[model samples]
Target: MAPVPVAEGIFTWPSDEPQLIGSRCTSCQIVTFPVQASCPRCASTKMEAHLLARRGRLWAWTTQEFPPPSPPYAGPTGDAFVPFGVGYVELGGEVRVETRLTVADPEALTEGMEMELVLVPFRADEDGDEVMTFAFRPAD
Candidate 1:
């Protein structure tokens, strides 16, 4: 089965080292993830597509003890549910992104530890294709 992106225009495809796509305001030099058309800080329309830092440091994290709400979370259901880690990764002080953590063990996680962007299987489509999404993991 072919692997597909969870969302398009978020990261580059067929890459060895994936970098997030973001929007940078030309006026204020502010960067935003998901590539905003207008600057959130200064409301400037002079935004340009920018590639985000692939490596960073873990800032903070926590484990989701319960499964998230349905209708929005298209993940495992009922007994198939598994808790996951979520945290903020500060990318070279350019931005702090709240992303899923690949580390399931809490003990393995430490604040200020080096991290790198990684793509992981989020779910499978009805066609049996795997849907991949971005996550942060301990740097290699």
Candidate 2:
């Protein structure tokens, strides 16, 4: 089964080094991921699509030892619970994203470590097709 993106219009697909397609406020210089419809600070509608830096620095990180409440998190739970890393990654002074970290081992991460954007398997849909999502990992 083909891997499907978690959502559309977030990142370029089928890429070795993909960039997060975000939005930039024309009124101000603020940038946001997931392409905000309007600037959060200024509430201006003059937002434009902007490609984010693929590489970033790990600002901070932590691990999820248990499954999140199932209503929002559609991934596996209970026995299938897999500990994962969650963190903030700053993209070249553009923006900081709170996202899933590809590295599960906390010991492998460090403050200001170089990180690169990547696609990783998230979950399987009802049809058993793999659902993929963007993540960050130690840069090569």
The C-alpha RMSD in Å for every predicted model, in order, reads 1.1, 1.1
User: Where does the lowest 10-residue lDDT sum fall in candidate 1?
Assistant: 75-84
For model 2, residues 1-140, the per-residue Cα lDDT tens digits are 99888899899886777888989999997999889899999999999999999888999899888899979989989898888899999997989988899888978989999999889899999988999998898999
Clashes by residue pair, model 2: none
Candidate 1: tens digits of C-alpha lDDT, residues 1-140: 99999999999886888888888899999888879999889999999998999999999999887879888999887898877889999886888888999886889999999999999999899999999999998998
Residue 115 lDDT (model 1): 94
Q: Residue 135 error for model 2, in Å?
A: 0.6
Clashing pairs in 1: none
TM-score of each: 0.95, 0.95
Candidate 1, residue 12: how far the Cα is off, in Å: 0.8
lDDT, residue 5, model 2: 89
**Candidate 1: residue 46 Cα off by (Å):** 1.2
Model 1, residue 66: distance off in Å is 1.4
